[model samples]
Each structure stands twice: as C-alpha cells, then as structure tokens.
Target: MKIPHKAHVALVDGERFLFLRNDGQIFDPKLSKVEEPDLEATNFSAGVKHQDQGGQISGSTDLNELAHAAAAAEWLNAKALANAFDELVVVADPKTLGEMRRHYHKELEKRLVGEVDKALTHEPLEKIGEVLANA
Candidate 1:
C-alpha cells in the first residue's frame, strides 16, 4: 500500500479519528497531521434499514459508538461530494470500516485508494506510516 504523495489518510475508530497527509514519496511517506473537519454524530433510531445493503440495522450493544461511526462515514461522504481530496486512504477498525462501506458515496469510492481493517487511530504517526509502507 504505497501512499501517493500528498494523499489524504484517515485513521478512524468509533471514538477517535486522525487526518493526515503524505508529504513524501509513495514508498517513503512522511505523514503530517491535518485539521479534521468539524464532525457531529448522526442520530439513528433502532432498526433503521441500510438501503444500500438491504439489511435491517439491529441496535448495537454500543449504540453511541455506532452513531459515531455513522457520523464519520457521513463526514467522509460530504468530503467526497466536495472533492476535498484527490486520493484517500482509510485505516479503521473493522466495525467502523463496515459502517463506512454501507454509506460510501460513489465519488468517495472513486477516490479511495486503499482501506485497512485495523484499529490504527491511536497509533503514532511514524508507526502508522511504517505499517502502511509495509502493507
């Protein structure tokens, strides 16, 4: 998973998210933190259907966390609609990734370069770069 130069990288989880940019070359990425857009949790009631997946969303044990993940996906969708970045990579926990997948806008899908289903939100920037370089 070589991160293209200046590519936007989002490391997200249910509770935390880090926005970064790769300033170096594809194989040797220098990740620099970037300010994230103001994000608000989406309020979803229990049993709401997922239109794209054609599945009922049963209540999660951690409803708040699920809402937060939905919020992250919404933010990403908004960014995609705005053409905020040309290339995007997502590194998120499995649950968050799945939630995001259900809500991804077509534009976001086009710009997405890679996704890693792991919880990397808390990892240091250097560690994240290393992992991505080897991915």
Candidate 2:
C-alpha cells in the first residue's frame, strides 16, 4: 500500500472517519490530515439485521453502526460520482469496508488505488503511514 503522492486516503469506521492526503513521496509517505466531509446519514441500513454466514441465527448487530457505515458509503459514492479525487485509498474495518464496497460507483472503482481492511480511523498519522508503507 505505497500510497501515491496526492492520493486521498479515507480512514473510516462506523462511528468515525479521518481523511488524509499523501503529501510526501510514494516510499516515504507523509499523510497530511484533511478536513472531514460534510456528510449526511443515509440511514439505508438503519434497522437491518445481518444473518450469520452459516445461515444460523446469532446475536443482533448494532443497527446504528450499520446505518453509520451506510452513511459513510453514501458520502463516498457522492464524491466518486462528482470526481472529487483522482486517486483514492480506503482504510476501514472489514465490516465497514464491505458496506462501502456495496455502494461503490463505477467511477470510484476506477479511481481506487488500494484498500486496507483494518480499522485505522483512530490511529495516529504516523502509524497509519507506517502501516500503509509496510502493506
């Protein structure tokens, strides 16, 4: 995950998000913090319950968290449609990544540089850069 210079990096989870830009070189990347987007909750999965992979009943998932992830995905979709960023790298928890992937626009898919399936939303900028550098 050597992020290209100027690539937009989106670190997101159900409850939080941190946007960043790679201001340094590809190998020695410097992730500069970017402002949070003006996003509105889509609430698409507000009350949804996920079935277990085994098709068996399990404890219910957090409805609010699901909705939040959906909202983040919605925002990304809008940005993609508007061609907001030329290169995009998504770093999210596995569940959140799945939600975002479900809503990816074709244009966004084209711009996507990479995806890291881990929750880095609250990680420090240096840690994030290190993880991406080693990924």
Candidate 3:
C-alpha cells in the first residue's frame, strides 16, 4: 500500500520500535526471517519477520480488534500495518526528536500556514524555529 508523504512510518515488533522517514520515496526492506517450530504453536498469524518453518506472525491491525469486529479482521492487512515504515533510521538523540514532534510540529505547521509554500526547497530545517517565530 502507498502511504502518504505526510504519514510517518514506525517499525514496531512487540515491545520494541524504530522510526522511519517517509521522504516521499519508495523503499524495499531487506528483511531477515526466523524459523518457527510449529504453526499450531502460534498465537498470532504472519509476523513482520519472515518464518521459514511455521511462517510469520502479524501484529498491526486496522481500527483495532476490540475497536471493530470480525469483519475488520477478515478484511484488513495486519502485517503491513504492524510493521510500518519503509526504512528504520536510528536517531542519535531520540528524546530531542520526540520533544520536537510532540511540542513543535503542529505549532510550526499551524503558525506557518500559507507562508510555507517553498518550505521544502528554500527553508533550512534547522531554521524552522525562525519561520515558526516569524508567524
């Protein structure tokens, strides 16, 4: 499925997660698979990691299961939604990035409005603070 340029990708595997950039580019994940002992032993179906023996188990579900119904489970692609993000780029400082996104992104977007027409090309991302302040 094609995700929007604006949409963020997060590669989540159970308790762990990695964040990826959309960058309006298509990428193929060079995934590594693990072999499961038996298919009957599985609690979930089709994981993000490949399984040579019993097959992968999936996690990500659309609309949430209890949030929806059986028809939703039958229809939605769980694996793709769960193992999101084309590429997982490790950030040096996660706390800072989280703070920026949580505290600044929306305010920057809201403050910039129509003035950000040439934003991607002209404005240096480092200078976002200036643009946001200008608004």
Instruction: Candidate 3: give the clashing pairs.
Output: 45-58, 46-56, 46-57, 46-58, 47-56, 47-57, 47-58
Question: What are the root-mean-square deviations of the candidates from the true structure over C-alphas?
Answer: 4.3, 2.8, 18.2
The lDDT values for all models are 0.80, 0.80, 0.26
User: How many clashes show up in model 1?
Assistant: 0
Better of 2 and 3 by lDDT: 2
Model 3 lDDT, full chain set: 0.26
**Residue 75 lDDT in model 2?**
77
**Model 1, range 1-135, lDDT digits (tens) per residue?**
879999999888878877889998999989999966556776554114433343325434455566777777778888779988899999998877887787788998999999989898888899999999998
Ranking by lDDT: 1, 2, 3
Kindly report which residue pairs in candidate 1 clash with one another.
none
Best by TM-score: 2
Q: Alpha-carbon error at 3 in model 1, in Å?
A: 0.7
> Judged by TM-score relative to the true structure, which candidate is superior, 1 or 3?
1
Q: On a 0 to 100 scale, what is the lDDT of residue 84 in model 2? A: 78
Query: Higher lDDT: candidate 1 or 3?
Result: 1
In terms of lDDT, the poorest run of 10 residues in model 2 is 51-60
Tens digits of per-residue lDDT for model 3 on 41-102? 12233222233444323533322211222222211123234543222221212322222222
Candidate 2 stretches with Cα past 4 Å from truth are 46-60
